[model samples]
Target: MSETAVPLPAPVFDPARVRSAVEERLTTFLDAKAQLAAAQGFPAEVTDVLQDLILGDGKRIRPVLCVAGWRAAGGCGDEGPVLRVAASLEMFHAFALVHDDVMDRSATRRGRPSAHEAIAARHVGRPDAARLGMDAAVLLGDLALAWSDELFHAARLGPDQLAAATAVLDGMRTELMYGQYLDLLATGRPSADVDAALRIARFKSAKYTVERPLQLGAVLAGADVGVRTALSAFGLPLGEAFQLRDDLLGAFGDPSETGKPAAEDLREGKHTALLARALRRATGTERDLLTGYSQGVPPGPAEVVRIRAVLEGTGARAEVEVMIEERRRQALRVLEEAGLPPAAGAILRAAASTLIGPAR
Candidate 1:
């Protein structure tokens, strides 16, 4: 039988405290790895760069949600194992981001050079610098993935908890990889299939980012199927809304705030819903510009203005805003009906607001 502890009365938890614990766990784990690498004469630069990326100014959203899921599912007693699991999730996230950036050829991450770019920059003069960076960054991403497993193992879960958590983690990783595959297949070959774009978002962001993390925590707490079901109901639509907002911000948000190159998504010809809507409504030169995969439009002021006009002029932006709102409402309605612990519901409510910016 699963070893779920009884829920504390009302089970109030501070998000700040959870975030701090997860951060500390990641920091200390990485620190030990760094020292071991130094003593063993492994390349110190690997851990050095990873430290900056993992311990940087990330929002710690996944880890916090994991803890919230734990509390919501009546996890009690030692919080240590759950925190370590949360940190492992973050490390896995770092792996995903590194590979995603490589796939996107994204030069920047969080307003700094991305992993490949940074590695390439460090060895500026080599003839194979670009290829070398790409290769080395893939290795770095793999290392992060490896460490994620190591940290997860070090959590020292009991037999039942370990089995359950492993199932959740395995499913999450498999779904994420296949989602990335779908995304890669669809990218740069956009069509007016809103459903197609949404499918990508569902797998790529919704299930991978929100649903699985919440489930992982719940499973760690030995939650029953019913509680896990409630979490999925609450998490899926909210996660999709989160990605929809991300698509908008990618095309239209302030680069400083978003921490990426302006219009990076459009520049890559990503098959986002916003782009699909625009294509469905566009005509003549507007359509031509939207389909200009081979035109080599330079990422400059005029190009930015023109693409902005396209996304805005077609009403796609407004349409997607409606989509986001609709999904957010759906998720909230699920929350109200899920009969979750009050504290978990509150954390999720706040999370929804923050992800989509407090509903205008």
Candidate 2:
């Protein structure tokens, strides 16, 4: 199977092109939903807020990966179904982000006010506007989740394709929820448990972000077990590397570039692998500072500076960079061994390189 002859895809098989296609589908789907809501006399804000968030700045990574997976599996011809599925994944991601913002009490996302914050601003006159916004945001997230399912079902796959897609989607959703729960439980009380942190990363970001999206596309193409396995080999490690990079970004990234506050992870006491590693190595003043901050000591400017110093001084940041490089190498090796056709291999390889590059 590794040596099976495969035809090359068109040169137009570009990430930017695929992203445009996926966004178009999302816009059309959401526009129809908005019309339906209007016809039913539902509040326009529901669809309006959702539209703004959905159409906002995003990398469109999942959908692009899905398309790449299909190509890798040697599936070709009409891309309509796969494009719809990709849009569905993006919609599901919206749901996740919406709820996550409420959970973290985040003020912004993608450089703009978060869903709850946006909703709260709408009812500034109300005394309980903040609480009402949060509750309403939760419902909005549920609506997005439901709409994701609607998009998936409307993709119109065959029986076998539907069954395969269902297996992957079901596992992805369940694992993501479990990972999120674990993360919530560990919040504000970080431990020096690198393994636990990695476990959460695996389920929450790695598998959900990369592996399952690839599998969803592969299965939709009727990919064999070997093909599925190969994609996992490449996707899982790449996904981990991506999350590791994200952890670094969350802790030390520039807000201008990342669109999130620098050291936000430390401020929120997120049990990231970077923090876990730092905790394992820190002691005396550094250890005391991290512990205090992790245990509800609000990180003032001084504390943020001290925490950054500890993370850097302890070599935790450097070690995470090492981890990212290692995982990227592993993923590239798998891509080579998988012997995917040239176009698909190029797409996946480029994705890895772009997503898991050396931190500046």
Candidate 3:
């Protein structure tokens, strides 16, 4: 008689487990990078700073979504390759955040000094310490980007998978740069153009943050067009909601929780959806106050108070909350219809909740 054959249990989707796995891979990979840098006589600061940023506090949303996408697309084998690619996305994010901080002149990230700020402190005695910090941080950001590519290549994906992943990544990077450029031009000149604000959110956050990462993992599993479409249907709205939440946090969140200064968005004159709504709906002194602040002037504490009052009085804050809830619903609806495995769908729902639910 032939021996009885038994099937292994299907893999369950656990967001915490996925996050842990991705974090482990990132730590290990960056440790190796640190070692290589030392061996090559590279500045210890480069590796040390990167290690802090990469292994520090983050939700690891992109990587978790990547794994969730793979699971959703019927991937049922080793997670080794998937985790590597996911880690690459985190590295790329580190690059993005570092550059973003430099551009915004932000002093804090993850509740601590940003890369440039930290670098400056290290060379405090130098006459050109500030410039040196900025330049070195830029190089560090570049290195992170390059190392991200290295991570992706080192994943050793097959030719077909590599091609697919490459296409998505290239598009994501291009979209991000274009979005940032657009944002740069619009900053300090914010208008009531809700559509334009949403456009920025789409490219800067929706596609780059949520959609592409999901697509990358889906393609890795040989997902079909339907799965790709489903991921987009779910990803776009959720990503927008995520950014909107960020805008709110930037404006009003407790600095202790958000790891950044409150009203920094107002100070930077970011053309966010919230600002657009305030610009549209505010009247009289509220309108003038918002208009004045939107002209690129950094708001002092009193000015920030007035701006917050306008944001609240104009109903922009409440409107944004509603928008977030609606987007969350839309994403959940798509997840329901996607016909993904039960576990995968649950994980996606959890991710959506994490993105749009509340501040952490």
Candidate 4:
């Protein structure tokens, strides 16, 4: 299997172009909301914060995958409606990120204050500032979600397209919420059950991050079950690889590079596949040290250093790397056998690299 599925997609299917088009649509949509808020005497800060968070730097992966799915399933011509739907996916993503940060109490994202943090910072001196910020951020996330719905409604899709897209969107939202719930339950309880950890990754990140987005686009193009099935076979494994890489990033990536606190998963005690595997492989004192962490031991600098040693010593980190590679290769093989449109296949293969390859 190819190590890297090189991407030379046509301009219309290019990831960069898809990202630019989606971002511009989001900016325009938010600008209209801002104007309406000003007219209604609503707080401008609402749109302002939404703008800063949604318009902030993003990989736009969902939107890109959606478009790729459409093209792969033979969608073509007059991409205006498709772009609008893509932008709505991004709005939905902003909702997910805002709530995710609030849930994790994450301080920063993409190198800036998370939505809750930014909102709290705005009212620094108030006695209820922290609580107020959390409340406001929750509201903001809901508003983003509602607006995403409105955006989708306004996409002017044909009746067939709308019905198809709605079914996929409904499933995606439900899966994402349940995935998050699973993750919440599992947090602070790292375990040796690698399958359990993997289950969380599949629902919490894999499906929404890859599978549904692909299906959403394909359905919009009136894709048959065969095309959607093929995409799923390719997407699920690749999505798993994506989440594994994210676990590694949260465990060990630099703050400057990852734009978040270091060892966040460790600090939060997320029961990730990486942690699960380490627990599985460890022995004696090393196993105890690893178990101590799963039991809520503070991951202070020295403690984290020791845990890192355990992760390395047990070769769990290395094992996870091998897992990622295996998943990636599986997706590549699927892509090859799926016999998708050449251009669409190229776009997806390229996405695989960006999703699981070395982080930018």
Specify the highest-lDDT model's number: 2
C-alpha local distance difference test of each model: 0.86, 0.88, 0.87, 0.87
For residues 1-360, could you state the per-residue lDDT of candidate 3 as single tens digits? 898889887766787898899899888888888898889998889988988888888889999889888887878788999899999999999999999989888888999999998899899999999999899999999999999998899899999999999998999999999998888888888889988999999998888888888999999999999999999899999999999999998888888999977687766777899999998888877766776655446677788778888899889999998888888888889988888778778778877877777432
| Model 1: per-residue Cα lDDT over 242-327, one tens digit each | 99999999889899999987778766778899889999999779877776742334467677778789889999999999999999
RMSD of each: 4.0, 3.7, 2.2, 5.6
Clashing pairs in 3: none
lDDT of 4: 0.87
lDDT of 2 at 322: 90
In candidate 2, what are the lDDT values of residues 1-360, reduced to their tens digit? 478789664654578988999999999998998999999999888888888898988899899889888877877889999999999999999999999999888888888888999998999999999998899999999999999999999899999999899999999999999999999998988888998999989998999999999889998888999889999999999999999999988777778888887677776778899999998889877877876755434677777778889999999999999988888889889978887777778877777876776434
Off by over 4 Å in 2: 1-9, 295-298, 358-360
Error of 3 at 106 (Å): 1.0
Task: Note the clash tally of each candidate.
Answer: 0, 0, 0, 0
lDDT of 4 by residue, 1-360 (tens): 668778654465688989999999999999999999999999898999999988888889999999888888878777888888989999999999999988887778899998888888899999988898899999999999999999998889999999899999999999999999999998877789999999999998999999999998888888889889999999999999999999888778877888876567766778899988888878888866665654434567777678788888889999999999999889989988987878778878888988887533
Work out candidate 3's RMSD over C-alphas. Answer: 2.2
**Candidate 1, residue 286: lDDT:** 87
> Judged by lDDT relative to the true structure, which candidate is superior, 1 or 2?
2
